[model samples]
Target chain A: MKPESAVVSITVNGTPHRLEADTRRTLVDLLREDLGLTGTKIGCGQGTCGACTVHVDGVRVLACLLLAVTVEGGQVLTIEGLGTPDGGLHELQQAFIDRDALQCGFCTPGQIMSGLGCIGEGRANTAEEIRESMSGNLCRCAAYPGIVAAIADVAEGQGA
Target chain B: MRPFEYARPSDLAQALAAAGPDTVFIAGGTTVVDLMRLDVLAPRRLVGLGDVAELRRTELDGDPVRLGAGVTMAEAAALPLVRERYPALAAAIDLAASAQIRNVATLGGNLLQKTRCPYFRDASSPCGRRRPGDACSALTGHLEQRAVLGASPHCVAPYPGDMAVALVALEASVEAATAAKVVTVQVADLFREPGDAPHKETVLGDGDIITAVLLPAPRGTSAFVKLRDRASFAFAAASAAVSLELDHDRVVAARIALGGVATRPWRSSEAESAVSGERLTPERAFAAGEAAFEAVARTHENRRGIALGARAVTAALLACRGG
Candidate 1:
């Protein structure tokens, strides 16, 4: 049987959008393909990679694992919602730039999104806590030291 | 992934009514969506349990702490009452998955997570758990992460959740709602060993929606220790959950549950009996650990799990003493 599509009305980065989405479409695909918000990358296409990390109702979630229709009326936030180069950068983003937290930049968006969540949850108080909390977002380029430093810098109020 | 119809029911009755033979209930979708993407599971209908508000509550100020199935792992771990009363459960849930996953994955979904056996994940490989008639590749193939205890010749896949192991040690019970009535079953009775039917993992009936898990009030000091390949974001290689009551520095009661080396969340009555009336000395803890794995069957690649599991039990018991 052919699966039916449903209309989902969601608020993304303070902007409301209503779109006809396939029931099988994942949130990551909906963001990248349907909405053209390609900042959320699909690395493992599973929950392990964390490359598709985003925020739904202020909670960090794996976009690849969440169905688009399940998040109806949810407020979604992606890396693009954090800040832009022209509009200025979020504190965490600036910290990432200052700490040199990116080598390939493929995992930066996920790292930033997950880092925002870690800080929002108040779990970035120490280096061990930062590393343990950020373990889901794997950086294949081995940029963990700088990533931790960046998160700590913002969490500890050393950087903006 | 194959296309499927989705339904978000607002109440337990509607949720149970939406479920059918070809339907699967999705809470966090951490495991279900991953398997579906791998083509390991393809259900024609998906019933979303997110809209059921009653399933997301947590009540801890009573004799039996009731944790709603929809309560996320992070929420459960961070609850002050849970941390004070059931430290083993808090540790188990905290050490599982990652921060992002803990924020989204629910307790019910965590209980029902599938194995991490490579053969089971890889569709090309023969896995009895994935297909009942298929061959068991882990029996002769790479068996490092396979089960060492409660394993049958049909399947060697291990249950990969840390929460269930702690629940078994804490003597928790799950409240499940069906179309007919609600039933409460012990966490220990929830799993079925892979004796002949490796495919039948749990005893959950058709249309049974797990509503909540009831944890008895804390009886003793408890701790959970997991030995894994990595510090975090990895499943346990060997783990132990221990709860002990002490009187004048002597063990009055003990409960032990093991993980990462069993077909299911293994409660070791032998280990508990070993230290029931004895002082919890280092030697006695080691003896209890040995007793836990006395009857364990090990393969060529999984022999290390026996010793590692023993050490985990000893370490967990010692940790209960603040050692």
Candidate 2:
């Protein structure tokens, strides 16, 4: 049976998008599927993995757990919203490259987004704090040390 | 996922009106969305409570600290009053899920969140909690994470939330609102032990919405200690929440609750009684912990949880003493 779709509007990276989204469609699905923003990855599909982390109203949330229609008239910031590949990378993204924070790169988007939120919340003052705050985004490749370094660097005004 | 109608009502009355036998209310969708994706829960109508702003209010001015049902775990944990007045509650909320999840997971949803028992989650497995009269796979398959204190022949799935354990120890009351009236119920009485009907988890009636949770004024020093597989982003293997009132070195009053070792938020009046009138000592605390799990029935794999739970209780009690 086909799920009924609803007309929902949200500002994605300063661009207002009005689309007909399935009521059951998650925020991640809305970004990756309907909006053609494939940066947000769905790892566990459950809220367990933070691979689908995104900013809703400037607060970081698990996109996989949020319904698309629930964020009507809200501002959403995904990985693609952070920086452009051709233009320039965000400081955090640059720090990640410099620090080699990623290995397989599957969990990098979530790590960067969560790191941005951690820094924005002023929770990345110390390495321990960075590690604790970024515990949501799991990296199976064991690139935690580098990721922590990159986040710590960006947090301490050492990046970009 | 099964197709479901979504309704975002602007008021509580509309939200209630939209709810029916086949309807389920969603706050942050941390638990409901996950279950829906897993096909564990497939409600025909999804009633969104996001627009009901009254449910998100947090009032901590006086006697009973009122936390609206939609108060997110992050908001509750970050509240200075909640941290100072009810450290156990704050700690429990802080120790749950992750930063991203905590930002959106509501207090009401946390209490109503289902067990993380592998069998209950995996639809293919025979789970008495997920499917009535189904053989509990956790009973024999993997008993390590199963409940020990509140086990029945039918189910051994442990209640997975840390906030409820703290709330129960704090002697909190939940204000449940229905179409007709509102009734306040003790937090400890909210959950039903999984017996013949493991699927029936809570005592909430049809269309009963938890509006707020009222927490009594802080009596004494409280602490929450959780032992889990990892340091963060994991459910407790054994956890304890203790609130103790002491005169000098002697315990005047104590409330003890254990989690991750029971089918529900297990509050031990026996443990509270054991600690009362006794000096805050390691031996006494250990004895009180033992009293809490005196009649605990453990499976072959989860026997360690019994000992671990006792240790957690003792540790929390000692922490309350500033030891």
Candidate 3:
């Protein structure tokens, strides 16, 4: 049988969209394929790696594990939404650049998104805490030291 | 993945009404989505429990602490009351998965999460736990992740979860809404060992919906210790949840539960007996740990896991003593 579809009304970043998506389509697929927001990377589709991390209703969650239809009424914040009001880079994004947090830059978006979540959740107080909290987003390039430094810089308001 | 219809039920009644043999209730979708993608579970219909507001509560101040089934692991673990009173449960939630997973994975879904057995998760493999008559591939493939306790000939896949172990040690109960009426099941009894039917993991009926998890008042000083391949974001290779009530120096009561080495969340009566009436010294703690795994099926494949299981018990007990 063909997959069922649902007309979903969701808010992405600051924009609202009503899209007809297959019930089986994951949130990551919906964001990248349907909405063309390719900033969020899909590392492991089975939730093992946190490359598809995004914010749904201000909570950090794996997009691959969530069905797009299940988040019908949710407000999603993707990596593309982290820019400032003046079109400048977000503090965390600038911190990532300043700290050289990316070697290959594939996991950088997810790292930045999850870094915002960690700071919001008060898990970015120390370098150890930042590493433990950001353990979800894996950078295969092994840029963890710079990632921790970038998140800590923003969390401590030093990068601002 | 097979095509499936989805329904977002707003309440418990509607959710239970939609339940059937071909239907699955999904909250966080961490396990269901993963398994569905693997073609392990191809339910025709999925009832989304995310919109059910009544099941998302966190009532921790009452006598019998009640945590709604829809409450996310991150939400529950962040509560100061949980960390202060039930350290084992808090630690269990904290140590279970990554930050992003805990943010969406609910307490109820975590308890029902499927085994990480490579054979069970792969659709191409013949797994007794996935199909009733199929052979368990883990028996001949890899024994490192197989269960050492409560394993039947049909299946040796261990239950891969953390919170359930602490709940069993804390004597928690689960409240559910069935088609006929509401019922409460003990956390320990909720999970079934791999007996003749390895597929029957729980006693829940087709239409049964878990509503809440009830926890008793804090026992004595409690701790949860987990040993895994990685320091973070990995399933436990061997773990122990221990709660000890000390009368000055002697033990008044003790509850010991083991995970990662058992087919289910295992309560060790042998370990309880070893330390209940005696003072909990380091030697006594080590003895209790050994008692926990004394009856386990020891093999060359699981020798290291058994040793780690014993050491986990010892570490948890000593941690409860503030050592």
> Relative to the true structure, how large is the alpha-carbon lDDT of every model?
0.89, 0.89, 0.90
TM-scores for candidates 1 onward, in order: 0.97, 0.96, 0.98
Worst 10 contiguous positions by lDDT, candidate 2 chain B: B294-303
Can you tell me the DockQ of model 3?
0.80
- Residue A132 lDDT in candidate 1: 92
State residue B25's C-alpha deviation in candidate 2, in Å: 1.0
- What tens digits encode model 2's per-residue C-alpha lDDT throughout B1-323? 88888888998888878879778899988999989888898889898899998787667885688999998898889888888889999999988999999998899999999998888888888988887889889877866677877778889889999999999999999998888888899999999998888888989876889999899988988999999888788999999999889999899999999999899999999888888999989999999988887776445666688788889999999999897
> CA shift at B308, candidate 3, in angstroms?
0.7
Instruction: Assign candidate 2 its CAPRI class.
Output: medium
lDDT (Cα, 0-100) at B202 in candidate 3: 91
Chain B TM-score (each prediction, in order): 0.97, 0.97, 0.98
Number of the predicted model whose DockQ against the real structure is largest: 3
Lowest summed lDDT window (length 10), candidate 1 chain B: B294-303
Off by over 4 Å in 3: A1-3, A158-160
Clashes of 3: 0
The C-alpha RMSD of each candidate to the native structure, in angstroms, is 1.7, 2.0, 1.5
Misplaced by over 4 Å in model 1 are A84-86, A158-160, B297-299
lDDT of 3 by residue, B1-323 (tens): 88889988888888988888789999998999999999999999999998888787668788789999999999999989889999999999999899999999998899999999989988999988998898878877865777888988889998989999999889889998898898999999999998878999999986798889999998898899999998898999999999889987788999999999899999999999999989989899989989987876567877877888889999999999888
Report residue B290 deviation for candidate 1 (angstroms). 1.3
* Candidate 2 residue B53 C-alpha distance from true site, Å: 1.8
